[model samples]
Target chain A: MSEPRNVKNLKDRINRIEDILASVAAGDMDARIETEIEDDLSGIEAAIDLLIDDLTDELRQREKMQKELETKLKEIQEQQRTIVQQQEDLLELSSPVSKVWDNILILPVIGTLDSQRTQIMMENLLQKIVDTGCTISILDITGVPTVDTQVANHLLKTVTSARLLGAECIISGISPAIAQTIVHLGIDLSTIRTKATLQDAMIYAMKQNKRSDEMKVLSRNALSDEKED
Target chain B: MLELAPDRNFELLGEYAIETEYDIVMARQTVRQFAKKAGMGIVDQTRITTAVSELFRNMYNYAGGGKVLIERGDVESHDALIITCIDHGPGIENLELAMSDGYTSGMGMGYGLPGTKRLVDRFEIQSKINEGTTVRIMKWK
Candidate 1:
């Protein structure tokens, strides 16, 4: 009678361990065996509990790392957006056109000239000409450090384009160094209207503007006189 | 060629691709900086930089693109800068004709090949009709 009772107790303990393992395998992290009796199976039961605890801890750590990676990716995307916005802002700020006087627009170039920037500038200047119907434009290069042959040729093309739009373009701010360099490079600048300083260019444009205004007034007067006759 | 050896400790100053007009300007600026770093005077710096600009323009306009390599070495107790321009363009059929003064091929604006030779201390150019062209210029400091 005592032997049968011990075997039944061992069977019950083994069945309880199987139930805990099944529940743990089914994603129940809290599943644990309650072993109140100390036996040879007690060591194995403790090891299974420890293994589940370590697994749960490792899963939590992986979840935290995945969340961190998602956050980092979001930050990188935000930075990329910010950089694109800044570049757009720079494009607008790099080349600015302003009407300084009647029928006169000044585009002060402040840095080195690239083809892209030149293209933008050409578009800006031409659009401003059409919008304001300005007849005179000044391209001030006082802050431009270097003017190569390519840049000079591009500027010449811009001037030609402005002429087609009924606007005259004056290139100003040829420094002493630039003048010397230009002469040494053997580039012909006689075809383009270039002034040594912005002041000189402004004065020349103002005078031309006044002369055209006078011509327009004279033409209007002559038409009225003829109509009266 | 014989004077510049590996023992002279030639440090690569820069390597650039001459593809566009803008690159010519950029290379000229960097060349000026390198010339200044090598203790060259302002005038010599300008001279060397201008020469390099011409070479860059040639490479870009003719070959559609090419490579420029700049190296600094000690030669005969003097610091020297060597610039090598390599292009796979339609090589010059006649080097003598190309080197002649004011002999522009297509455009009338170029400063001619001989003009570049006058600005440097040593100049060497080699070209094959269908292969390519290589121009090496050296300036002493």
Candidate 2:
């Protein structure tokens, strides 16, 4: 006895459904049974196609969102780099070192002093001192609002480092408040030369230059006399 | 905390909230201006300003943030500038030890509080272990 034709047709439809599912699972979304027959098998085929469509839509949406997030992160990183560059420019502008006179480099500190500023100021001053071989450098702190212990310590370090380079650092423009504060803080700034005003520092620097010049002349003359002898 | 004597009437001048380093500088400048306006001489003005600046530093260092209150009052027929600092941070465990010269938590010369006291006419400190610390310092003209 042969099997019924309807049962054989049903078996063939189920095998088709398995082949469609395998293709879909293998990442082939286009493998759909576009069945036109009006039966239970057709309904299952339609449901499988709908499920694949929804999954494809969701995946596309997620990919788009991931791209947008990547773009946003890159934008943030770019902004941060710009901000860092601008900050460096500002720092450079804040501590301006100029050769105001012969053998004198003047650095007018015009804002609040912090560790970073101090570090930069020290580097700039030291490098200028080496480049110019200037014996007298004036650090004008007239615009500085305060000189706390921390700032004082930083300034002291700057002065010490400048001295090591054979340059005498004159700290001028000591505000009344700062002077009193420094003294009250019990910080020993006696080692560093300080002045009441920039003009005073200038005068002191000129005198120092003149005296050194005279000493050089005297030494040269003595050397010549020794050579003559 | 050492407080202003209630008997002497005080005039509120200005109040400053010290939360950042810049705020401390502004406070010192403002307090100096206030002291000068209250008929304090240059030396006295500087002394008061320095004291307040030190107090602000202490507050910023230990308390994270604090408030500075400036008041003017008459003492012995002269002008007195009163400054009060209040902070809500870890309080000092030992007031007497903190007041001692060269006795620090071993940071340095330990002159933070003692040196400030020397710069002012009257100094008072009040603290609670977990509560906070309040310091009052006055300079008379």
Candidate 3:
């Protein structure tokens, strides 16, 4: 009778183990083999629980790392966007178009000349020409260290674009090195008026402005005289 | 004939598009930062950035678009910064003439390629007419 009882106890423990395993296999990570019986099956039950615990820890760690990576990516993107914005701001500040005379616009280009800055300079000059109806624009490059082929081409484009708006563009402050580079590059700026200094460019613009003003005055006087007649 | 060393480590610092003028500016800024990391002086940084600007502008104007790669490596026992510019534009018909100081394709002053070569310590160019052009320049610290 005692042997039969022991066999029945072993069978019950085996059944419990099978049920716990089935639950675990169905994706229930929390399922465990709960048994107070200190028997041969206890070791197997303890090992299964330890495996689940390890798996859970690893999953949690992986999730944490994923979140950290996402945050880092966002930060990098934000930094990139800020840098782009700052560059745009710098370009805007570097190229400033101001109306120095009633009919003259002056754009002082300091530092280095790049394609992007040249584009901004062109845009600013064109917009100012439209706004103030200025007929003459002087691009002062006294502070520019050098000019390359591409920059020279951009300058040509800017001058041509200004002409399209019915304004004459004059580039001033041709450093000797820049002049040599231009000549060596075989760029023909013969059609575009250039000055040796900003002062000279300013004087030329002022003279043109005065002449236009005189023409307007003469025309107004003529109209008044005809009215009187 | 110049080759990157097999044993040397090559790390990509950044890649930029030579699409718009703004892209050129961004490339210059990035190159400046990279040059600084290589422990270059302010003047060297400016030179490298200027070279990059010219190359990027060339790519934009000639090819309509291209790419610039900035990398850091150990070359010939010295720490080096490498800039590679690739463009799929009309390749140079005469490599010698293109490298000359006064030759231009009628768009610019024609000092771009030669001036860039003067700025860097190492310069190499590979091109095929109607296919594209690649320029590799390196500065050492």
Per-candidate Cα lDDT values, in order, are 0.81, 0.84, 0.81
Q: Where is the poorest 10-residue window by lDDT in model 2 chain A?
A: A1-10
lDDT of 1 at A140: 92
Off by over 4 Å in 3: A1-8, A11-15, A18-22, A71-100, A108-124, A140-146, A172-191, A194-204, A214-229, B1-91, B96-141
Candidate 1, position A208, lDDT: 98
Q: How well is each residue in B1-141 modelled by candidate 3, as lDDT tens digits?
A: 223334346798888888886677677778888998889976677667767777887888888879888999888887899998888899778989988886788666677888788778888888888888888889897
Q: All candidates: CA RMSD in angstroms?
A: 6.4, 8.9, 7.2
How well is each residue in B1-141 modelled by candidate 1, as lDDT tens digits?
112223456788899988887688888889889999999976677668767877887888887878888999876777799898899888888889888755678753444467577677888888876677888888999
Order of candidate numbers by DockQ, starting with the best: 2, 3, 1
The digit string of per-residue lDDT tens for model 2 on B60-124 reads 88889898888888767767888989998888999999887667663334667887898898888
Pick the DockQ winner. Answer: 2
lDDT of 1 by residue, A5-75 (tens): 22237777788778888998898989877565567987887888898899888888999999999999999
Looking only at chain B, model 2 earns a TM-score of 0.90
DockQ for every prediction shown? 0.21, 0.25, 0.23
With candidate 2 superimposed using the best TM-score fit, by how many Å does residue A107's alpha carbon deviate from the native?
1.8
Instruction: List candidate 2 segments past 4 Å from native.
Output: A1-90, A175-185, A221-229, B1-11, B74-78, B93-97, B100-110
Docking class of 3: incorrect
State the lDDT of candidate 3 residue by residue for A15-131, as single tens digits: 866777788678677876655556677788688778878877887899999999999999999999999999889989988899987889999999777656777888888999999
